[model samples]
Target chain A: MIRPGSTLGILGGGQLGRMMAMAAADLGLRTHIYAPERNSPAFDVAAEHTVAAYEDEAALVRFAKAVDVVTYEFENVPAATAAILGAHAPLAPNAHALAVSQDRLMEKTFVAELGIATAPFAAVAGETDLVGALERIGRPAVLKTRRFGYDGKGQVMIRPDTDPAEAFAAIGRAPAILEGFVPFEREVSVVAARTAAGAFAAYDLCANEHRHHILATTRIPAGVSRGTEEAAFEIARSIAEALDYVGVLAVELFLLTGEDGERLVVNEIAPRVHNSGHWTLGGAVTSQFEQHVRAICGWPLGATGRLGRVEMQNLIGDDAHAWEQVLAEPGAHLHLYGKAEARPGRKMGHVTRVYPESD
Target chain B: MIRPGSTLGILGGGQLGRMMAMAAADLGLRTHIYAPERNSPAFDVAAEHTVAAYEDEAALVRFAKAVDVVTYEFENVPAATAAILGAHAPLAPNAHALAVSQDRLMEKTFVAELGIATAPFAAVAGETDLVGALERIGRPAVLKTRRFGYDGKGQVMIRPDTDPAEAFAAIGRAPAILEGFVPFEREVSVVAARTAAGAFAAYDLCANEHRHHILATTRIPAGVSRGTEEAAFEIARSIAEALDYVGVLAVELFLLTGEDGERLVVNEIAPRVHNSGHWTLGGAVTSQFEQHVRAICGWPLGATGRLGRVEMQNLIGDDAHAWEQVLAEPGAHLHLYGKAEARPGRKMGHVTRVYPESD
Candidate 1:
């Protein structure tokens, strides 16, 4: 088992990686960030860093050999990169979890096979396949590229007046999946962790809101039934067990409220820490980032109890400029990612406010 | 004003500096740690580090010039070193605070002159002066070197039978002070912050217990009456205003319970973050380290509301070996400094447990 003094190698150097490195350091572990970008945010806080492309086998081998275990901040790690690192050192969540989550089609199919609910989806490899898939999925379906899609990018909407061929062409006719639209009541997520020893812990369900195709706010006590919350936990546990996951994973779901009752449909799976889980940093007894480090280190999963009724709002782009005002507010916790540019749609920082349950 | 992306240069690289660096990063500020030690713990989490003697003027100048503002983790920063850095950058808790805190005689005199309560003390420069101090302060007094004393070092307890000349010789006959010990009921401290704009905030007073003269545990609800608590804050504020202090400063005091009522007597003043403030990291709405960063950067001070009933224990030497057990305990927050060895009396880590007020 990895001990406290062991070094952890992280694959991505974004905010997620930055938080993971801080968590690792809190547990007395040194971190080595390996990312291709020169000003990767995680590099500033880590003990060691290697600026090299993910496909560079020599750098990957040396990085893996330097640290006791490896983990990643993003789910789209190339399968070959995972294999190379796994051969040299243990990789948390394993390569199979990455492969399943990297593709939209595989993730839906895997969830469906496990008796979980997901939107009706069909693979479309060619223009003809789009026609057949569109006929079954119906109008208002989304044609999304099977891989490398994030934040509403690489996807096109197919409404009644829109052409299926045009939507497919918009995504460059890449291997894609057409998913039937789910008009749900709310979007919620379960951020959980699992260890190789089969221990599982899940934080309270949190409802999410989106703006301009980016996460805007996340609030705890998702306002769902206790039964619905339990079901969410079960879905996350089953998915984690099926992948033999050994780190934190977030499963986003659409909570549909129909005339009969409430139902949850799996939206997507993030193999690593998710932006929606940022609330847990100070709102829960154990933060999701620290929980990920504990699981990957083969340590006990920390308590997932909520500290209070929590609301977290993302400071996207220029929103972070109001940090001085936020800092002046009493009891508001502000966190900023050390990015120089505040480009539109870029996540600059976040603010969290936790109130007593009664309030 | 120092912005979020600016670098904060810290003078010492111990655990206090390590925690401060992490807190600074949380606010989007990068950190540069300067310490003489080869393996200073803070170096692991900082963006930059300079390993050179504090007396090295060139290194000090370069370190100060590299960052927007400068702060230190320890109170014993040499006056010359502070002057050199102050010329290059803005130093929080300025050189005067360091000079007053570096020597016991000056600290006591400063506190006494501010109309605050302190033990009776006299300067002892030679053996003859030691005899005069002993006669004036009485037999059961403490002979402490004016400079460079920590964790029970550089001080000797004098009993009625102890020879005055022998006590003075034991301390190397350096510039010293003889203080008449106070028979106190308990030891408590006020951990507070002051911004350059003169904004002040103080956490709830906490009672402390020490083992072998090193802090062992600190508990909230010091059990002193409301009036006593307010008096403690007043004392801290007066000291900060007198020194024109910026950043976190801790005032240690003795609670003497007499037939009349509860009274507070000043013991010593720490110009930087103190061990008594570690509990605030997770037990309070805002941590002392983060408050220090905000204050020194010309930002508003954070709220100091207590989250709940909190208890903090230091893991000294082998106490850290039980880290696994501590991690397994739900809701126990463990923080380990990245130190390679656990030498006797060396602070290795700490654990904090916060309970709901109702509990």
Candidate 2:
């Protein structure tokens, strides 16, 4: 068993990895970060770091062997890398999860097969497939690449007048998935964790807002009915169980309101910590970062009790320039990733404001 | 000005430095920990680290020049080291504060000169000085070395009929001070932060329990009268202002109950974060670590609001073997130092528990 003094190897040296390393340190676990970037934010906090490409088999094996267990900050970890790591040490959330979440076609299929509600999606392998899928899925649909897509990248919208060929061309016709747009009244997510022993816990459903297809703000006590919140938890639980997941996961969902009342459909599945869950750092009894560490460490999960009404806003690009003002605001917890440069849409840091429940 | 992305250099590499580096990381500040030990705990979380002796002036100058501001984790930092760092980069809680705190006699004299109540004390340099000071201070006193004493080391208690020469010999007759012991109801501490800008904030008075001269437990709300609590804060503020101090400082005081009600006498002052303040990590709106970083950065002080009734217990030595049980306990925040071995009386870790105010 990996005890407090044992080392944990984390792949992907981004803000998520940085926060994860700090959390692991809090629990007395040493962290070794593996990333190809020299100034990776995670490297600053980890006890050890390997600046090697993910495809470097020798480096991957060395990193895995050096730590008692291995985890990752991003779900885009390649299948072969997971296999190499798994061969050396325990990999949390499993290789199967990476395979499923790495491809939109596989993720939608997995969720649909598990009887979970997801957007109507059809695989589009080429221009011919895109034309056929767009016909069936209808206009005003999203044509997204099956793999290697994030932050509004590798995806384009197809409207009624827009050419299907142009849409496919826009995405470079890369094994796409055409998902019919759902008129979601609100975007919310269930961030939860599951252990190998089948134990599971979920944070309260959170309402999320996106700006320019990038996560902007997340508020707890998502303005959904109690029944809808419970249903969201159920959806997350089913997904975790199907993946046999260990560590924190996020399931983004669309809350559709119609004559039939409120309904939830899975929009996306993040096999690692999600941006929406950042509020838990100061708003929840056990931060999601710490929760993920505990789960992957095979320790008892901490209480997911919310401390108060909370809101977390990501400081994207120039947004972080307001750090001074935010720091001056009392009760506002600010977290910066220690990134040297702040390019447009880059997540430089985040600010979380927590108010008494009465507020 | 030291801004969010600025690098902060720390003078020590123990657990206090480890926690401070983590805090600095949280606020977007990078930390470079300078310590002599190879496997210092602070290095695990710091952005950079240098293993060099305190007397290595070249290394100190290089470290100072590499960072925007410098603070330390312990008070016993050599005056020359502080001067070197300050000459290169801004150093908080100036060298004078360090010089006074590094010596028992200087600290008492400084506090006494500021009109603060302290145990009756007299300087002892030799056998003649010890005997004469013993006569002036009376029996039942503590003889502590003027420098480099901690955790009950370098001190011997003088009881009635005890030979003063033996007591002096026991301490190697080093430059020392004889302090008349005060019969106190309890020991409490005031952990506060002060900025060079003259802003000050103090957490609630915390009653501390010592085992083997080491802090074993700290319970906040000290159970002292409102007046005594305010008085304690006043004493801490006066000391900070007198030193033109910056960063977090702890004032250990003896709480005595008598016909005049509760009274506080200064026992010692730590120029950096103290163990008794660890409870603030989870029990206050802003932790002492973050507060220290903020103050030293010349930022606005944060709210010192307490969350509730809080208790923190140090996991000393083999006591950390209960990590499993502690992890299983709900609402308990466990913090472990990444030390490989847990020697006797070593602070291996700590667990903080916060209950509803009513509790």
Candidate 3:
């Protein structure tokens, strides 16, 4: 077992890593953040930091040797980097999780093989394959690159009037997956944590709304049927057990309203703490960041009980400029990532508001 | 008003300051910690730090100039230190608060003058004053130095047979106060915060138990009558308004049983966050640390609502060695100060356990 005072090495020095480091510190564990960028926000709050490329084998070896366990903030951790670190220390959410989540085709197949509901998808390796896959998946499908996609990036929509080859070329003709569009009623996610001992705890289902391909708001008690919520949790548990996951993972699903009331179709799996789980920081007994730390450290999972009715809003781009106004509002917990610039479409911070339930 | 991007200067580099700095970062503010010790625990988590003597005018000036506002972790701030910083930037909790709380005689007089009840106290400046005060206050009183006392230090008990001169000399014959002991049932504290606008909010009353004069455990709901709790809050409010206090302040009081039921008498006032308030970190809607940052920054006070029944236990000396066991316990929130050594009587960390109220 990883003991207190042991250092946990984290890859990627963004706000996610910064929050993870803080959670680790609260558990009496030290954090070492490794990133190539100078002024990485995580470095400011960590016990130690190394500015080096992920491909730098020597630096990776030294970082792994210095820490008791290793985890990463993003799913796109290069396979070679995971191998190097795993050789020296325990790597949580393991390399298999990274491999499956990194590729759109593999992720869909893995979820489908588990007898879980997923949008119909086909692989596209070339223009011919794109045409064939487009025919199989039908119009209004999404052509996403097999690797390096996030926040609606590395993908193009294929509508009835749009050309299949053009859509594939837009993604640089990389090996991709064509997922048939699902006109769903709403998007919901199951943010959960799993320990190596196979213990699992999931937060309540949360409804998510997106604006301009970016998450704008999240509300808990998603208004789905009890059956749908239970099914969502079961899907998450199966995914975690299959991956042998040992950290917080989020499963975004499309809640389709049918004759049966509500049906959930798996959308994607995030291997690390997700933006959708930010509400847990103040609205739940234990935050997803802290849950991730506990799992990675091989500790018992904390209580996932919700505090009250919760709503979380993201402060994207210029939205964070009104931080002073937010701070003045009572009952609103405003959190800002220490980023120097307010570039468009950037996630600068978030605000969570929790209300008491009616008696 | 202090803006979100502004810097917050913190005095006294201990766990309270460390948690306060973390809360400042959460609200989009940067922190600069100033302390005399070379390895101050707070420095590891702060954006900037100054290692200098509290009496170092040059360093204090530079620190004050660098930050937009200043606050301290403890009440024993030197008058000259406050003056130096106040000249350069806004200092929350103000200078008068420091002056009043630093000296036990002044604090008691101020509380007593406000029509609030306090343990009968007399100023003892020398052997003559000690003898005169002891004769009047009688035996079973505490002889405390007027300034710079904490955790039962700088105070000696005057029993029935102890010589007054010896007790006075033991405290170095410093200007002191002889406080008439109250036959109290329990010790309780009100951790409250006030803004410059005169807005005040207090957390629920907490009952404290000490081992060897150091805090061992703190339980919320205090097991006190509602009337007693209300009176305790009124005392704290009057004190804050009297001193024009801003930021979090703690008022320790004795819960004495009267024929009418429970009554409270003022014990002492802490100008900054107190150990009794540590439970707020994970068991309240807004932690005392965050409340202090919000008040100092001119932001609205957050909700002081408790999450559930909570118990906070301090990990002193070798007690911190059980950190791993604590981490493995479900629902236990462990907070370590990153102190390098576990010297006897030193506070190394704390654990807070919160239980849901039974319906």
lDDT of 3 at A314: 96
Q: Give model 1's docking category.
A: high
At residue A60, give the lDDT of candidate 2.
95
Candidate that would win on DockQ? 1
Candidates 2 and 3 compared: the better one by TM-score is 2
TM-score of chain B of 3: 0.98
Q: Point out the higher-scoring one by lDDT: 1 or 2.
A: 1
Residue lDDT tens for model 2, B1-359: 58887899999999999999999999988899999999999999998999999999999999999999999989888888888898999998889999999999999999999999999999999989988998898989999999999999999999998899999999988999999989998999999999987888999999999999999999987898999999999999999999999989999999999997899999999989889999989788899999999999888888889888999999999999999999999999999989999999999999999899996
lDDT of 3 by residue, B227-314 (tens): 8888888989999999999999999999899788888899999999999999999899889999999898888899898888999999
* Regions of candidate 2 where Cα sits further than 4 Å from its true position: none
* DockQ per candidate, 2 decimals: 0.89, 0.83, 0.57
Q: Model 2: how far is B145 from its true place, Å? A: 1.4
lDDT tens string, model 1, A1-359? Answer: 78999999999999999999999999999999999999899988899999999999999999999999999999989999999999999999899999999999999999999999999999999999999998988988999999999999999998999987788889998999999999989999999999999999999999999998899999998999999999999999999999999999999999999887889999999999999999999899999999999999999999999989999999999999999999999999999989999999999999999999999
RMSD of 1: 0.7
Q: B1-359, model 1: which lDDT tens digit per residue?
A: 89999999999999999999999999999999999998899999999999999999999999999999999999889999999999999999899999999999999999999999998999998889888988898879999999999989999999999998899889998999999989999999999999888999999999999999999999997889999999999999999999999999999999999999999999999999999999999999999999999999999999999989999999999999999999999999999999999999999999999998877
Q: After superposition, how far is residue A209 of candidate 2 from its true place, in Å?
A: 0.3
What are the chain B TM-scores of all models?
Answer: 0.99, 0.99, 0.98
Q: Which pairs in model 3 have colliding backbones?
A: none
RMSD of each: 0.7, 1.1, 1.9
CA shift of B192, model 1, Å:
0.5
